[model samples]
Target: MRRSLQWVMYVAIKSIVVSCLLLFISGLVQAQQQDQSVTTFKELTIKSDWLGYPTPETVKSHPGARTVITNKELTESGARTVEDALRNVPGVRVFDESGTGILPNIGIRGLSPLRSEQALILVDGIPVTLAPYGQTGLSLFPLTMNAIESIDVARGGVAVHYGPNNVGGVINFVTKRIPAKKTMTIRETLSLSPSTERMLADSYIRVGGFVNDKLGLQLQGNFINGDSIRAHSDTQVTNIMADVNWYPANNIDIKGSLQYYKTKNNLPGALTPESYKQDRHQSTRPLDRFTGDTLRGSLIYNQYFDNGAEFSWTNFAHRSNRQFFFGDALNADDTSTLERSSPREFLVYGSEPRLSFYINKGIKQKISIGARYMREEVDYIVDARDLLTNEFSVARDWRFGNHAFAAYISDTFFLFDDKLKITPGVRREQVYLDFRNNQTGSKESNPTKDWLPGVDIGYQITDAIFLFGNFHESLRPVQFTQITFGGAQAAERADNFEVGLRLTPLQNIGVNLAAFRIDFDNKLEFVSQDVGFRNLGKSRHQGIETEFTWQPKQIDGLDLRTGYTYIDTEQRSGQFKGNELPLAAHHQLNFWANYSRADWNWNLNGLYQSKSFSDGANTLIENEEGSIGRIPSFWVWNAQITRNFRWDKRKIKAGLAINNMFNHNYFFRGVDFSRGRMPAPGRTLLFTAQLDF
Candidate 1:
């Protein structure tokens, strides 16, 4: 362990030295480029506030398929979990395994949803995965819903701007920014499950004000304590965030943010079919637990020139420690117990700098160039003990380090009287990874490089109609565990293609339609026998998605929205060839309606998912434990009502929400091999109140 630690430190130091040199050179270039002459052409407005809610117009203007869930929608829908907020988004699949929403398994366009490893998750444009190259799981999202201002989901053709792990897409959580004026907000919520007699409470507070004309500051705190549907499954989460924004010059701005998060959750292992039938709320593994602590800090600087040019840079660092304990209890009848503790520590730091400018000579063009460098280190330890004899059984320690460097450039050219646009971009990335085991004195190193390219084409049919198409390639390197346990697994790669159209034919109506296809090669799959991951054969996913929104002009305070998605997934080669991908639902639909008048708002939403297989073999044989089988179709409904009022010069809002309004009995996820079912919670209710001062 000592020797491995020393080697990690050495590599870290060398990486830092190289990063400093590169930063210095980039700074010099930026300084010299600042004096360039300005052009009259307008630059393609890069979405700087990926942290802010985008309007419908903004979504329509994007070059690729995208969705934005706003705070208003969150509030009106009474969404307590990220999955709830995203339920209306087409092509998104969320498996609420924990029921409390602490650990969410999410997938996009038929991709693997386990631990959300296939997608990229970010907070304020900074990656937040526990370990991007080592663990690659979004075990903990730093911020809660109350502290989040919006969520931006960009799908298809995102690799040029964001590096690896864009195979599915990018989900960015944007937190509330410092207020320009003095403000304070407080909110509290309580949820109850009548059947299980479980209760959950959430609280949030935010205070912000301007210190001076050039400076502003904000502070936010969030707390959540909840009891899950299963017995003994309790969780607690706490978050603290601080922000400072300064405008030193008329065209220059700087922002800094710090965040802290801590969480602990008790796991309720899956139950057998007979056990579930007897008592779905009973826990099989009551001693299992998960805990994590994370701290992150970031600084951003932006400079805007009079000549339609902009430069921005961000530097960020994060440290997190997490531990998980799992108890082996397949059924209520088991007597023997196996306890395992896996603890990991992650350290990550990175910088991103981008430049944008416009040219109007002949054909108008908007261009952007950016560079990124990041380094991560992880220390992992695992220990096992037998409960019967109280004896130690197994112990292991591993250390890994990863260094990544990338550069990308893109240009959007306008042709045919600014009605047609083409964006071509490419990213060059190189990754260096090293792993070592102290006990075995084993060391392995792998350095990989790739050049990914993408393009987006858009044609404006009219002021309110647009057509767009995009193609991009994505790659995900083999995770540390796969490398260490599976002996150097190959990277996962994919090609994504999408075409979409946005239309606003009527004043109160908007519609979006899209078709997408993803070809995956060397996909990663876990093998139980080897207890490791391997490169599976090729697979294909093709889908069509549509969304429509209508606000009746004749009926005041009434709005309607609906979305539908159809996916066809197939394993092209291997033993499971020609079989539908496991857990990939074939069809999904979402509908929502809202009415507001006289300070009263009423909302209703529904979700439907088609049946899917639970395993790669498309197994139909029902196991006694319900661990492997075909998942039947299911539907869920939720409703909410809110009232706004003022008392003694204070603004107050109150609301009530009922989930699974129809009392639907269904499961959102399944265990492929065991057929073990994780039952979904029944009817649940929640009440919320907010005060503004």
Candidate 2:
């Protein structure tokens, strides 16, 4: 573990160097123009402000690959869930097995799933992960899409300020910061469909004000209820949130927030081979049952120094418990052998503490760099039936804990005073991992040490065009979620190279094109099994992603966003090599158009992904020397309309959103196996209305 003193010393030295740079810049500013000397970035309304705040000026000077979705986009999309809204963004692919809530395996760049361990989900600067179980944001997400102010995606790699687990990237869902004035809000939504029906209610009310600046505090909550196509299956979730902020000091601010969530739902597990023959969405066995809940709190402190440097820290913690079983019924052997039995259970508790340093002005460079430390601890216990005894017993007890030490430095310097921009950066990370096994002592091992390094670069070709290229390496260890009786696997290593261009052929329109190739060694691959999974070897992922967005400055209310992705894969060395990536499409296209005016808002969203194979083998069946399995490609659509009304100083917006608008049923992902598949949700309509005063 890195001692606190080491962290402090690391930051102190960097801060001293940065302070000196700032002083030098101050001296030069008198000779040059203030506005002209600032490193101006191509600002977008979507808030690429991923590195810091929403000021377009601040982001242009940020040091990493960043992308954002604005508040308007979030509201206009009429997306049912947070992940639903983000999937349309380039470089983001969300694969859900069923319509059962959100199943997010959010991959960035060309990371291999098996080795893709790190990726952080942040809410109000707080890290959200179900510890012990290692289920990415399982306890914290499924957020109501409309409440978010924007979604910031820090692509490639980022520092640990937002908390570790983000080797692939960091996604921060910055919710609506409380308004500066007293206000009240009430919102409700109802959806009815063949596969599911849900009702959600949430409200927020701000009270009181700080000394000079307006003070703000608010409360928000949501409830969702639904059922799947299977037996003895139903799902429910309730989330409550509170936030308070104080900006008494003009240059300093502090905010505290808390969120509580509960879910009585199923994992949408796989069905047997026989069930597929009857109906892809049908199941005979009572393969259902799951329940879970979570609670968390966070405190964030931010300070802005007059010199243009900013600093912040986020402290957060959460706990969760979830259970799974074969519906509410018990099997003959399992029940007959035991006097009393309970469903399988998993529990987690964790805390994430992050510190960030943002320096916007420097003598010789336009830079944003910082160092961060994250300590996350997790514990897991499982109970399964014995082979002969048939009675369930303590099958596994595991403890997963890691402390990460990371630092990054980057500078984007301007040549010719301001025209050309050149950026260079490097990051280093050291991780410590320990696993304790109660299943048996043989499984106990502590690989407590590893180091990874990263580098990135970008340059401007013309004022309207930019060229960027980067190469970095990252390590993905076998997280707690991958633990199985087969023995934990070794960490996977990846070396990635990418080169791209960001172009603006016309003002108000932006286009980005990137081609990437990643090589994976010791990639994690697994197979179906009870309790755990079976491992497979090395694999690779390489692909291309593009995005085009238009938010015309002159147009009063018109915004269009579109994205296309093309991915190519080579197994390298595995049961399946030179095969395309499965559970992922080779080609994906999405387009969204929105028109918002004072009285009404109109929106349309559409998506189509080329067919993809299932599982790593790409092969369908195995029992009788081999069979066939293939999932055909599909298309999907969604649209919404909203109108606002007022009642005695209160503001209200009513809207209807239709998913799968054409009612064409499809597969969430191509399914190929006796394990059966889940049909995508049929055409569904959601009615929602919100009131604010």
Candidate 3:
């Protein structure tokens, strides 16, 4: 603990010194350019200011594959969960373990989808993953769909700006900001299932206004209560957030935000094939439950100089507590029912500073430099007891801490009369972790460092066509759990190569195609029932993703969009060599169409996935219990209709949606060693109403 404190202090002092130096340089630059009028830093009104929520045009200029889902797409899809919204993003895998969509198992490319630990998850550029270097479960997503303005997924070549676990990519959730004028909005939604009656009910309210010419305030609240498709499964989630934006000077802007979230979920354990056939809605273990709460705060500062240079800094902190009580069905022997309770507390604090400036040569060049420092601490305890007596006995108690520092610089040079762009970047990252087991009086520590470099090149072929390519290197550090139990584990490294094209044949039509390959070394594979990990040596993932969108002028308001992905993943050098990775489908497709005329809007969407193996061994034959085998391909469809009206200058909107239109039955995730499978929800209906004043 003393060492950790000292390290924290050292980083703090270094950050202060660097910040002062940057400020001094910025002041000098401003003074030299005082003759020119400085542009005032506007309040946070556009979503693009947030790190990940880049606009479509911005995405076209990005170095590698990127997907951005905006509010318009969210509204048209009527998606109740993040997984639903991400379906259109190719190369992303969503394992629907929780029928209510509260606990998401998300993966990008061919990475493991276990708890979404391999990917970096952020909210408005602030890390939200619980215990990033220890557990890293995205169980507590504080904001609801109503509060989100955009979702961005960057597949690779992002390590230069985002650090640490940028192995798979970066997923950033951007929340709505204060509007320019006073506004109040209320929204309500109800979901139902033929098998379980009422499935979910949600309520959300938001108010935003300008307190003064230089100040803005916003407040939001969301409450969601739902019953899962499985029997005895219930969930409740609540979130409250507030934001204040102040412009103390014409060239300076400051924003502060705070958010609180609490959630409880009743976990219905998986069931065998016979039980599923008898009744899919029946729960095998009804007492399993999970609860969590999180509090987060952030302060942001931005300064603009007359020479069009910008400096920004953000400081953020998060604290979270989570508890899980679940049936140990996999280890149960039928003689005695066993249960386990795991409780964890996580604390994280971080700061990031960035400076960007433009150089006007023959062609303009943009250069950005950034530095980040983060410290995280986690305390975990596990207890075991009999199901009947409920007398718990301590099994394990562990404490873990991680300290990380990273610095990066990126330069984008424009050539060929601003038609060709070349970007080169490099990032240096260092991570240190310490772990102690209180019950056993044992301690361990590990330190890892890496230098990542990348280059992106883009050429405009024509007025409506563009071609781009990128190559980057990224790394994922071994988590504390793996190092503590599995002994020493090597950090995973990945080299990604990608080439893509964006073409706009017409004003209303867009097409994108990308082909990429990733070489992974020292890959870690979960073993021992996911309690530990084993070095898989080497692996490779190669895939192609294509997307098309069209808005026909003939059908004034008609919109159509579709995307497809083909992935080939192999374990190159391991015991499972020549085998396909588990749970990664070979083919996936998504399609959506929406039409709007006047006050009425209608939309339909569908998703399809090919077969996938359930175990690393690539098990093909289905067992008697249907637990270990290849999952068959399946198709699911959804539709929605909305109507808008105005009464006395107050706007009102109503919508109805149907999910799983055919009631298809399929499993996206599976447990190994004859464990039961995770089932997806059946046909469901949802109704929504919104009022704006």
Candidate 4:
């Protein structure tokens, strides 16, 4: 009763603040309305500033494979984590180690998913990696499920605008939009895992609205506290975010965002084959744990001119700290007397400005030009501790820095009455690296540059069908370790090609098919700790992807969507030549079905992946240590049901979800030092409730 009263009081205070803000902003709106000289153009809308496509209809003209998951689809699928939601996209792979998505291992196409090194992750077009230029690894993902509004995945044709490590592509998360009227939401979720006898809880609160026609503000907070399905695995996560949108003038718009995220979690270290078979849900390495936090902010400004031209400038900065502690042992069961801890800190700052306009010289054309500059710094340290005496000593200390600059230009030509479209673009990149071994007082510096070029072609054969193709060159800057401690001196490069078509056979049915190939050179692979990192020669990755969706008119409130991917990868050089890459499954499939009637909703989902290798050698038999082996094929199913209730101008939603309905067991071979059989989660259930006003 006391907690309830506190909530009531909080809500009342929030209402008072909202009312005052609205009244103050309404007066400004009226004054702005009196000045009719200011012009408002649709092209300068807030959506146009996003890095991803402005609207769903614009996707049809994309030069390469593109996938967008809407908020409705995510909510209806009962997606408790980002890894679960990414399974619906074709040619994408997800591996969960923490079970909470705090540390994501995502792969696009056939690239390695180790820390998602090859992929570029973004939130509202702002980089989220620990050090976007020096480290490319995502040690901490600072995002909450409730704060997301949509997801956009670009598989190819992005190098002209994005850079550094976009070899795999870009993944952008779009946050929830500010509402037109005052709104508030409170949500709670409870999850139970019978196998491990653990329960998890998640709480979320959001308040947002446009105070008036000229300004908008939003605030969101999410917290999670619970244990994973494994013993000794306890975790806590906190996230807070704020956003502001101000249109001081009719043709000028400004947006700002700030976020803080922190997490503390225990790592259920890998288990030996014997231990895994005996009890996969037990955690033997109780000393292993991880802690991380991030503080980020961004600002965007846009200006529109009467000549149908727009100028946009975006600036962002972030600081992050991550630390991991684990036992130092050759195998999971080894009796090691020493423990190791790695602490890393990063600071990043970036600015980008772009201009887009139209030109007509007997043929309609669109032109875009952009420039970017970014700086990143990292402090990496390694320390060792004696478990018996509790004594600590520093082993290695290093600092890395990077200065990067890029400029790009693209032009789209419309011919044959706008039926045929061709776009050609090029980007120039220059990077300067600085590294210092603090322990030895040694320093190294180097400079690298690259030229990336691409072309996209699209033909509208008919109103119902669109055909598109693209060929682009991309580059991955040399990693910090590669330049300072490894034998690699040149940057990695790849040529990407894709051909795809989108069509609608019926009013309610849509289909998309694409074929892609990537030829990569100077691929970097991590050797042992003593050997550091090295270039593993060339490799080839090619694949086919198809997606289908149907919303039949005959059946009210019924929807179906499915996607499939087939990838073929091979090593072209080195000792592993003629062998298939690790974790590159040959086939993957996903299916979803949903139906709604009145206030009731039902959803079902299915996912499957074929067998793959755990090591570059493609070992078929599991070793005694369980560090290398072939992963078996597995399939899982999920179902959910939801009901909505409304009364007295209040709305409420409740839902229940069952995951891994068949209780299927699956495991992945360790990628880092935790070398052994890492078992995945088992059957689980989730109950959720939400209140809106």
Candidate 4 local lDDT, 76-190, one digit each (tens): 8788788777878998988877765566688999888878888999888878887887778777888877898888888877878887688778888888876766689999988
TM-score of each: 0.91, 0.78, 0.91, 0.92
- Which TM-score value belongs to model 4? 0.92
For candidate 3, list the clashing residue pairs, or say none.
none
Considering TM-score, where higher is better, how would the candidates rank from best to worst? Answer: 4, 1, 3, 2
> Candidate 3: lDDT of 602?
96
Top-scoring candidate (lDDT): 4
Determine the backbone clash count of candidate 3.
0
Look at candidate 3 and tell me the lDDT of residue 406: 86
Give stretches of model 1 more than 4 Å off: 1-53, 330-336, 485-488, 527-533, 670-675
Candidate 1 per-residue lDDT over residues 440-519, each given as its tens digit: 98988766688989998889989889999999888888777777764557777889999999999988898999999999
Query: What's the CA error at residue 251 for candidate 1, in Å?
Result: 1.3
Q: What is the alpha-carbon lDDT for the whole of candidate 2?
A: 0.56
For model 3, residues 383-486, the per-residue Cα lDDT tens digits are 88886887779988998888888889888899988789898989898889888999888888878788999888888878798898988888888787776774
